[model samples]
Target: MLTNFRRPRTERMRGGGAYVEQRTNSWAALVGFLLGRGYSAPAIAEALADGTSDATVRKMAQRWGLPAWGRKADGFIVIPMKLRDRATIASRAAQEGLGQEEYCRQFLVAGARERGTFRSVVKEGLDL
Candidate 1:
């Protein structure tokens, strides 16, 4: 499902041991993904690039509710429950006004992102 756009992008990835996940090619790519979940086809079509054809929306619907990373017996995307939980938690944090580092900290307590506090290191700070 498409989380509210106002939410930060920091919640995009969860910690390890998660399963498959679905993603849009870009910020706008999620338009097609959400439309397939019963959003108005016309409205979604007006916004999505991959939505050039109705078939695209149909395919998205056919693939809805599956895991984000793993395919089901029908070959649809299916993310693991662990990953989903982390994503949801982070998403909520973002919605609540947490920044990138805070988002990661809320979901990932001891992962690589935390190991170096790398999640908040945007390229602008590199001083390259």
Candidate 2:
């Protein structure tokens, strides 16, 4: 007679713990270490020279919600503001209790509406 048995809960996951966990843990650690060192995903990918595209690394960084110093996650171009303009922005954003970056994003969106870009995009059935 044969006795029935079940695999351990950990063994039933995506892969058995030993082989898969080692590799996955190493990869996660390396990525985290690079990010903590202020290395952009693209820079990390380049350093690895692993044939992965910068764009792919960039998307991965965004998916992980890694901060990019002062960059927008969606790859939007950031406009440079002069000192006086920046001070004004800071004042307005402070009054509204929002971060300067967030305030700038909303201000751009509102400007887009006035320029008809927002309406045109909506008419084209695309979600902004």
How large is the C-alpha RMSD of every model relative to the true structure? 18.4, 17.3
lDDT: worst 10-residue window of model 1: 69-78
Candidate 2 lDDT over residue span 68-127, tens digit each: 755545444445568988999999999999999899889778867677766654666554
Residue-level lDDT of model 1, residues 1-128, one tens digit each, is: 33343321312443573743334245334643554344554445544443245555556655664323233232222233576666776688879899744665654554554555654554545642
Q: Show the colliding residue pairs in model 2.
A: none
* lDDT of candidates 1 onward, in order: 0.48, 0.61
How much does candidate 1 score in TM-score? 0.24
Worst 10 residues of 2 by lDDT: 1-10
Instruction: Report the backbone clash tally of model 2.
Output: 0
Model 1: lDDT to the true structure: 0.48
